[model samples]
Target: MVSTALQPVTLSEFMQLHNIEESPAWELLNGQVLQKPMPTFYHSLLQKYLVRAIDNANSVYEAFPELRCILSQNSVVPDITIIHHSRIPLGNQPIQGAPDWIIEILSIDQSVTKLISKIQACLAEGTQLGWLIDIQEEVIMVFVPNQPLLLARADMALTVLDEIALQLTPNQVFGWLKR
Candidate 1:
């Protein structure tokens, strides 16, 4: 008797067909492959501040700025991914498991349809926190599983990532964009 085997489509396999060359700052999210654009002046400013702030806080967890990960069949590259020190996986590829926190810096290339699905997928995949930063609105939509999201304006403080007891004030974060 002969047996037939089934093959599964993996995110890594998908990326291979995408021409994903080596770039220090590239990521893939949910089959929607992309290379991060040259950070607009504002993007670079916010990214630097976020990385610094998280690093200085000294959490037991690790926070990676602009990290890439494979979420099921899709490749998601979040702006920042904070993973529990214990949960972090071992590998040279870096992101071996779901991150504890994910930050997506909204960009012109992203669509509303795309962002919502990716956020929902992350939440379901063991990511504890997710933030969608809308640069023009200076608004952030914070997501935590089984809870109402906390949306912040420039003045409000968002305690989305509580692992380090840190809260982000929108006005303060956006201020980094000032010319």
Candidate 2:
């Protein structure tokens, strides 16, 4: 993530700037603009597999990639956003609140601290689950409401929304890259 030194802009102004055709996605963190890094091969693959796994798990929730979520004064485009079917925003408008689940795959050279801060921001705004997948380390940092940070590796089963009937592990997630 590259932070811009420009003066802070309101969310509405940021939205206008973000809608330019063919422009790279931008995030508003604490009223500052930050350019998201382009995803690497592994980052892209992990996002695809995770979305597929979550979407296939059940109909109660759906996972979307690169969806912009407007949370209060901050707006973020999480790598993957999972929303309960009933809570899905009704129109062409971007999601107005934090998603039920937010997943971010760490890109090469991206700041892990910033990513974790993003996840924590979402968690503070009602997100039930958050994950930061570290492809190189083959581990996942899990975030849940009111709980300490948890790390999952190898065959450790990952936690998911209670309504979703899928079981996953870091090993299984990384295995997708083998194909």
Candidate 3:
């Protein structure tokens, strides 16, 4: 469901209402609370596979699932975030910075234009790469500087960080939900 509010609030005020068991996912984008749907089974599985594969390839990546990215006065919890291991926050709060990689799994409620805008925001904030995975179309949209590539099938493997030797077949990822 979309937010019913006509006015925006401060990011600090937004964080104060944080609860892990909340119904929908909420983020402070431009200091306004943005709510999106919770993950379905397929979405959740892909998230896990990405994390596990990354962890297996290199133990040094600081990967967090649903970890909030704290900005100047707002917070955004990307679906999955991959940062350098040295930058992991030790406390109860999320860190500020465009994570090296931010992955967003699409939901039916979000518009394509809106998602692109969000990816652009990440790029402006210093994110090296942003991925928008479309489950329905079975394609992955990758945003890199000066280029945007769409991978329609798992056979077309994807690579975000070059240092890590990880490969994911789209079919393998989607197949996990069948069982």
Q: Can you give the lDDT of residue 54 in candidate 2?
A: 89
Task: Report the CA-based lDDT of candidate 2 relative to the real structure.
Answer: 0.87
Sorting all predicted structures by lDDT, with the top scorer first, yields: 2, 3, 1
Error of 3 at 64 (Å): 1.5
Query: For candidate 1, lDDT tens digit of each residue in 1-179?
Result: 01111344357665566445444344445444445554566766777788788877888777776677666656666777877778666665757656678887787655655666777788888888888888988898888899898888877977656658666698888877874
Using TM-score as the measure, name the better of candidate 2 and candidate 3. 2
lDDT of 3 at 130: 82
**Most TM-score-accurate candidate:** 2
lDDT of 2 at 144: 99
TM-score quality measure for candidate 2: 0.93
RMSD of each: 6.8, 1.5, 2.4
Model 3: how large is the Cα RMSD against the reference? 2.4
Instruction: Score candidate 1 by TM-score against the native.
Output: 0.81
Q: Total clashing residue pairs per candidate?
A: 7, 0, 1
Ordering by TM-score: 2, 3, 1
Distance from true position, residue 140, model 1, in Å? Answer: 0.9
Candidate 2 wrong stretches, greater than 4 Å: 18-23
Q: lDDT tens digits, residues 1-179, model 3?
A: 25534688786678777462265667766645677677787778888977887778875675678877876655677788988888788787677777788888887777677666667777778888888888898878888867756665768777668777777766766676676
